[model samples]
Target: MNRTGAALLLVAGAGVIAVTLALWGQPLVSASGGIRLWVNSIWSPETSQQVADWYSVSHLVQGMLLALLLRALPLRRPDTVLLWSAFAIGVGWELAEHTDFVLDRFRATTLYQGYLGDTVLNAVMDYVFMLAGVALARALPVGASLALVAVLELASSLIARDSLTLSTLQVVAPQQAVADWQDAIRPARP
Candidate 1:
């Protein structure tokens, strides 16, 4: 699709996400009625309320992976398809992530015990971040893109004790050993 068409598609997707979140009783911003550019702690109540957090890295990786997957398909217009597919995937994930089933699953199996759904702003920004990842994947060589993914996964895991890879593994197949290791780094609750 043309640049204008792609931009319109993304804007429409964001609108849908925001409306859905509001319908689901998600606030437009934090309870404090403020918007933050970033929240560093994955354990913080504000993590998913803010515009960006460590899991934002995971969304970026999702975009890259989606782009790669679409490109691998035999579509005649891979670039155009990538944009549509990424939008669909990002919107679908945001909608699904807020559901009780997914939220409860994450709470039970992952480090996100305090997990609530993202605020509208954060969810929209996540879609934007995912688009950024698509851009990154298109700009770099395949090997470089893979290298960057490795670096992002390793760094996020090392810094936060969680990453996309770890989160996926925990959700798909919970392990007491890994949970213990992740919980070891968590600050004690008051």
Candidate 2:
């Protein structure tokens, strides 16, 4: 298939996955009192050490794959645009998650115990990471620069959930965890 068709296919696939999960994904707090979490699951900060991967690992690699798909490649401008576009798209999803489309599902069912969209803090970091990715891509060959993402992502994961650089707010009723994460992160980060 052509580039446009392929891009459309990717987008359609993402939408399908999202809707399917939102519609049929298991409830966060099952009727029997068990807990479920997806995307990211660290019950407590102490117990879990962050992994070197998040969605971006796949995302960037997919971008490279996409780079193979298109012919109008600048290698620089496109990378920058792709970086910015990733940021914009992430922000958009965050926004969408907060809106009625996602909220309605949560209210009608317990697919997620608590459903909240990305916060401003997460939004800021997303941009930072996108810039970091763009800068890395500029400084080195594409794959090598992308490798830094794993290191950075891991280092970032080492941080407290509330750190400026490391922002993960997953657990429900996690104010204490958030506080602890905040406390744990501040001294080292400062």
Residues 1-190 of candidate 2 have per-residue lDDT tens digits of: 3456434544544454344334544222223343322224223321111222243333333333333332146555564455445545544543454566666553342223344432232323333343344444555665665465555555445632322123323323334454555445333322
Screening candidate 1 with a backbone cut-off below 3 angstroms (N, C-alpha, C), the clashing residue pairs are none
Could you give me the TM-score of model 1 versus the true structure? 0.95
Instruction: State model 1's lDDT.
Output: 0.87
The candidate scoring highest on lDDT is 1
User: After best superposition, candidate 2 residue 150: deviation in angstroms?
Assistant: 6.6
TM-score per prediction, in order, is: 0.95, 0.34
The alpha-carbon RMSD values of the candidates against the true structure, listed in the order shown, are 1.3, 13.7
In candidate 1, stretches whose alpha carbon ends up further than 4 angstroms from where it belongs are none
